[model samples]
Target: MAMFVHLTAAANTPRIRRAGIRADSRGQGGVRGVYCFPVLPSYTLTHQWLRELARFGPKGALSAVHVRLADAQEVLVGHYRDRAKDAQQWLTAAEAVARVAAQPDPRGWEVVVPRAIGAREVHRIRAVPQVAGWRYLPGAHGTRPCTCVGCRIRGEYGGRRLRERHPHPLDGPPPPVPVLLARIEAAGDPGDQAALLDALHWFGLRRRGPVDRLARLAAHPDPAVRRELVWAVQGWSTPGVAELLDPLAEDPHPDVREAVADVRELMDEQES
Candidate 1:
């Protein structure tokens, strides 16, 4: 037999006691499933997802649902990002445990089942600490604090001081409009997507960046940059935001166009 753990809001404990862990595709992909971790020999490793899941899990008490599976039961296992991107392959329950066990740092290892689990499948529900496992990213503690504009949300506690102390090379407040325009232009190196995204974030934060200058970003080769441009324009207070988004609505990439649609809705909301 192979043991697995699923972390969820403890409020659901009663329901889970009856219905087990019903699959609901929380993040990307059409796969309606539950995410779990194989229980290995290591105590800390067995519940590694606790703190990381807490970061995204709904606020309040959280618990671990212990699940048991036959050695031959099939599942999907891989790096967290791989599972998110739908890049993992199906492995037997025993093999998944073996793969995770072999890893030196299995913080990002994940297991996903593609369908609902009947209540009978659950072995037990155990209460665990609300705060356990690594967060921000695995092994984030030993490294310098990351003050990336993306990582440091405005309303987050200590965000300002975090940036002041351990500044990210690519993230900070935007310069004056003219200087920012020059910096965005000079950040054209193919390998510098992080710099490009950080600079684009400045546009979103400032909101009043000249629409004309912002329009030029639609031409950047990266679809992600173009998508970020539409998201940035969504915050513009100026009247030309609608006009600026016209070209993006017709962007070749689906994601860019999707971003354009969101901006359009924001404009509609503001007008009404």
Candidate 2:
């Protein structure tokens, strides 16, 4: 039998100990499966989702349910995005282990067993660190809190109030970056425009972004808005990022100028 680890709420330990893990509708079209990670040599990688999955539960501990599956058992394995896109592939239990082991960073990867796991297949349940991997995304803490509806899932354990405390400009279909930037430029309230400007940073964080428009914010009337503007362009690695930050470096307000220096220093550390 192959070994795997299923991360579940510590509250469900008794139920799992009694009836084993029953496959629920964790996939598309109500497809039920026991979702788990392969028990690899690296314990951290094996239970990578321990922290991420814990976000769905109340303020409670999470337990790792060790599972022993037959090598012949059929399973579905792919990156979590593949499961999201309904592009999962069928593989033997052993094959899933091999597939996951080959990946350099398998944080968003998954293995789905399409059937229930009997209690006998349960090897043991272990207590793991509540804080294991990252939440939202890797290095998410480096950026400001995101208020987009999609980023803030309903019923998540913590941070609901904090995430919702800010205005969610992305409650629905958001306009393109250029369109939204135009709106922010024309928007009446400088405060609201600053808030929107902050949100725009995450749009193309690691991609080429609209830096030309962002560069113009160096001349905003309010120092606070210009300060926020400094943060808004901090994450872009685009060619024009330096050009945009150049003007902010000479900003009239010390705070805005300071923010530009901080962003450059922080981004330099990140890039290095």
Candidate 3:
């Protein structure tokens, strides 16, 4: 009867593993590169949105607060037709700002938009410390409950209402919903249009929801509206929605094509 003693691998195996890791680190296949996704930080993304909003800021602050720039380049490329001199100018400016803001580093810039604040007030607020990134977003602060048109709509349609007018410690009472909506809508700024659409989308109004009013805008002459419409439709997935987006997929604008791709992803997600 022969019993064999178990033999163990060399203790140097651990050191070998460490060396291999170190070697991998020195090359592109290193640990750092393993998780190397393009680091588009939230702040940078927000900066892009802000720059797009600024293009629509010739109106009130609320307008400035609402432009969505998730795909600024796509939007520009899709909708920037030489329709009007002013439109071209605005598009040019928006594109330039977007290019800068979309850069990896936006340098801690902030644009603030307060409820019912004017240009002077915005300038004053921008000077505040810890407000380095303060951006005066156009539109009323939808924090606290208020009787404004926007708020009223919010209360009526935004599900169940609270028993009393309790305000948030940080947000206070929101401005009247109607006022906010009016301000957001009356501001013809393209940025404002985009921003309002963004707000409506976020407010759970996308698709067959309360924000269905926006769908009519899908056919707007402005390609910008068409682009935003594509984005908004992502939240709405019903039968025939694919048919609605098919035309947009073939849109002459590259941005529209890209928008189609985004919406397609949403469709794919829903299917999955």
Which candidate's lDDT is highest?
1
Q: Taking the tens digit of each residue's C-alpha lDDT, what string does model 2 give over 1-272?
A: 88999988788889999999988535533356888989888877787787777664435788999999999899888876663445877789998888888888877788888899889889999889887877776556577767675476545545566655666765433456676666666664443654565456454332456777666556768887777766756766677878777877997788888788778766764564
- For model 2, state the Cα shift of residue 265 in Å: 46
State in Å the error of residue 242, model 2: 54
The global C-alpha lDDT for each of the candidates, from Candidate 1 onward, is: 0.77, 0.73, 0.37
lDDT of 1 by residue, 148-249 (tens): 655655555577777778778756466677776777778764425667776777777675768886677777788998888888778777778778788888
Best by TM-score, which number? 1
On a 0 to 1 TM-score scale, where does candidate 1 land against the true structure?
Answer: 0.67
Candidate 3 lDDT, tens digit per residue, 1-272? 11001011233224323331111111111111100011133533332333333222222231111122222222111112223323322123235454434645443322211112122211111111111122223232364445432233233333234424543332223344464456446755443565565454443343343334444455556676677667755666455556667788888778778778766854664464
